[model samples]
Target: MILLISPEQTDDIEIKTLHQLFEAGLEHFHFRKPNATLDEHRAYLEQIDPTYYPYIMTHNFPVELTQEYAIKGIHLEERKWREQGAALETYVKSFTDKGFAVSSSYHEPEDLAAQPVTFAYHLLSPVFAAISKSDMQGRGFDVRDIPKFIAGMGGINAQTTPEAVKLGFQGVGALGGVWNAKDPIQAFKEMQSAFAKAYNKKI
Candidate 1:
């Protein structure tokens, strides 16, 4: 699973490239626009071909967006997950019952291990130095012992994706690695190919 996260701010070029990416076999697009309002989010989705709606996972307005669009799933940011407290399981279940994939993010391996609520998958970050944020350093987390579908984030690209796999991530997610490249679509394909080769070797 090579998940591509949207850049914080929207750009016309990025949107156009995203259409190309979807056509080029990209799956699991994390539609995260933190600063965008619900209306803006809807506008963004409207721009994309509705046929690809099932391939998107919204990071904001999970219930509302998923209810309106046939997106793949909802991602619970660490803060939102923590806010749920005891209701976390029930909250997650509500979506899972509807046959939606529920995933969450974690910065620490220990925190992920301690999490009681099961997710469709877990996104562990800073496995490698972050490209989008210069100040964030990589922790090189090893999730081999964690019994869940884990995807590594932070500085993931064609070159570093395999390293994440070797560290035991079942999948990898990226943002800058793809959007920052000169050719976003080609970068995605390369990263996708690299992940597949590495994951195959791991098994």
Candidate 2:
């Protein structure tokens, strides 16, 4: 799948860019705004086309909006997944019982392998160096043996996305590769082309 993550800073251009990307066949959108307030988050979603709501996934306040907006799923950050422990299991169950997909993140391949398979999917990051954060280096780990639920993330772009697919990632998630590009929509299409070229299928 081709998942586009929101940058920390959201602007009118980014919002318009995202609509264009979705219209062009972007499948998933991770709505992560760490700095935005709750009201701001609501406002941002309000501005987006309601038809695109089903493709949206939020990292924050997911429970409140999952049913409210009829969104696709919720993504629990690694911190919440770890700190909440069993309590989080109940939370996941609540959503899963209602047919909501649950996903999370893991910084290490080993951690993801060892953890119970509760999440529908989990992100394995820094797999090809971070595009948004230069200081964050790529692990270059091969996750072919891991479960299909683990998506390779970080530093994912047109060039690196195919590499991730070759590494056996069920999906690839991009942030800076799209939002940081000269033409974000074009970059997304290029990423899609790269994925198709490598995997022989559309994202």
Candidate 3:
């Protein structure tokens, strides 16, 4: 899987680029805008072609937004899932019952392994030095033994995508690697091509 994460902030050019990426066959789009309000998020989705709604996974207001739009599913940020405590399974089931996917983020492999509620997939970060945040150091996590469908985040780009695959990541998630590129569309295609070459399967 090749997951593309949204930048924290939005811009007109980014929106246009997003449409182009969707057309270019972006499958998993994590719509994460931490500071955007619900209305703002809705507005952003409205700008995109509705046909790509099935490829989107919102990071905020999962319950509200998923009900209103035919988005792929919801994502539980680390804090949100941790805060669920004993209610995590029930929360996930609520969406699963609706035939929507529910994924979550984790910082540690052990924490992800011990997670009781089975998410559609799990996101583990800082596998390499982060491109979006310079201060965060890379952990170089190797999940080869983990049985879960874990996607490696942090410092992922065309160059490091094959490395992540070799490290046993079932997927790769990118933010800065694509958004920070001189050409986001070409950057995405490069990552896809690199991933396919490494995994021996098209994403």
Candidate 4:
């Protein structure tokens, strides 16, 4: 499953929470800290169990760090997408040379047109009214609106993950739904079970 680390700060509790998530069968992690400094991010990384999860750094941070940690890949935010999209050939070649897979956020169809650089995947969002951000709209996408080469994020959890899969998402990512749960392990199991149910039902 995809576990998105949207911690406000690199605090002790956040680190502990991340460790728990990693232990709970999460292998894909997205570190999308938009306001953190390089030092702050480094400090957070220091707290994580490097061997367990394929930690993906946001484009705002230094890409070199991923190589240093031997992480799976990097999450290309808007900036990286625009910058790399301009030179897709060179960008893909260099990153692939380093054995790094690429993932990025896509909120629109226009974004899809620009993608073909051998990215491992993409994340589309706000599939439901997310508890973390109640004011944010769920983008009104049901099972019919999903795109190929994409996973669903934003407010996704045990309850909605099944619906997300039915809508054509290959995987699901979570934030407050899992992290803010009264019992994270239970939440993880529920989400995992929901995904399994969807997969089995399809077969």
Candidate 5:
């Protein structure tokens, strides 16, 4: 899947554009507005068409709230998985008991290798030159050893998506590649197409 991550800040225009993207078949949207308050998050969810709620995944929220918003799941930051240690297994199981899909992030292959808690997917950043952050250089990461469910993030777009999928990533996350585009919805559509073309071949 092509996961579209939200910009840290949102405006009315961006919210409307996100609706358009959902209508255009954008699945797995990681709704990560870390700075927004819970009330603000509620307001944002209220604005989105409820029919698209199932396509969203919130970052940094209580799992119970996912039920309230009908969100598909929650993505914990990499630090949580690292610091929680063995406690993560029981913590995540609680979510699974309620039928929530869990995900997390990683900065390197070694971190993923060391992680014992399984997730629906894990986002590995800086897989390519970061589209949003200039300093997080891509370094042309070789991803052969990572699990298939780990997603490649950072600077991914239509051109680089196929290669990431080919390298064994089950998914990819795009921030600047879409939100920073002249047309975010169109950028998402291209990303969807690229992911389908690449993923279909592996089957």
Candidate 6:
């Protein structure tokens, strides 16, 4: 199970929560504070032990931020992905050549189906209603509705991870679910456990 930790707001509490996840063995921790400046982000990165996990920068800031930290991957937003067009694929290919992986977001299955570029995988969203996005509705795709090689994002947590995996999500992304939990580390573990159980039963 691949655990993605995305905190909507990065604060001292959020940083501590992330530290807990690091100790809990979550491999992929994406730093996606959209409102934070590069300097603020750097400070947050300083608190995290980069050697223990894969840290991904969610937006295309400067490549320098990632280069400085030796982070393994970058996740592009939908707008940046659309704007780059062919350049996005070229960028991923270039990163692949350099040993860095790339990921992007796609809301709909057709968008993923239409994708012609290579990425580690695309993140498809709103598998359930997220605390961060209460207004957004989930697609509620069953196993047959999902294609191969897509990660389920939005509202993913311990409670819904089983359903997400049974629906054929390659992995699951958590936002407020883990970050806002009473005990984030435990929440992460339970979520991973759920995915593992569901995945095993499916096989």
On lDDT, the leading prediction is: 3
Query: lDDT of all the models against the reference?
Result: 0.92, 0.86, 0.94, 0.70, 0.84, 0.74
- Which pairs clash (backbone N, Cα, C closer than 3 Å) in model 2? 129-138
Scored by lDDT, model 4 comes in at 0.70
- lDDT per residue as tens, model 2, 165-197: 878887889999988999998999999988878
Model 1, backbone clash pairs (residues 3+ apart or across chains), number: 0
Per-residue lDDT tens digits of candidate 1, residues 1-203? 98999999987687789999999888899999999999999999889999998899899999799899988999998999999999999999999999899999999899999998889889999899998999999999989998889999999999999989999999999999999998898999999899889988888
Note the residue pairs that clash in candidate 3: none
- 1-203, model 4: which lDDT tens digit per residue? 45565655455577777677677777777776778787877776777776853655545454656656766767776566777556866865677678777777766645654566667777777777776787877864553453457777777888888888787777787877877888876888788889889967866
lDDT of 5 by residue, 15-113 (tens): 889989888988889988899988888888888888988788888765546758777888888876777776899988888778788888888788786
Better of 3 and 5 by lDDT: 3
Local accuracy of candidate 6 as per-residue lDDT tens digits, 1-203? 46565665656576676677777877776667788888877777787776753555445464767577777778777887898876877777766776777888887778877788877777888777775678987877554554557778877888888888878887888877777778778888898888888888888
Q: Using alpha carbons, what is the TM-score of model 4?
A: 0.87
User: How much does candidate 2 score in TM-score?
Assistant: 0.95
Q: Sort every candidate by lDDT, greatest first.
A: 3, 1, 2, 5, 6, 4
lDDT of 1 at 125: 91
lDDT of 3 by residue, 93-169 (tens): 99999999999999999999999899999999999999999998889999999999999999999999999999999
> Candidate 4 — number of clashing residue pairs?
1
Give the C-alpha miss distance for residue 88 in model 6, angstroms: 2.0
- With a 3 Å backbone cut-off (N, CA, C), the pairs that clash in candidate 5 are none
Reference-based TM-score of each model: 0.97, 0.95, 0.97, 0.87, 0.93, 0.91
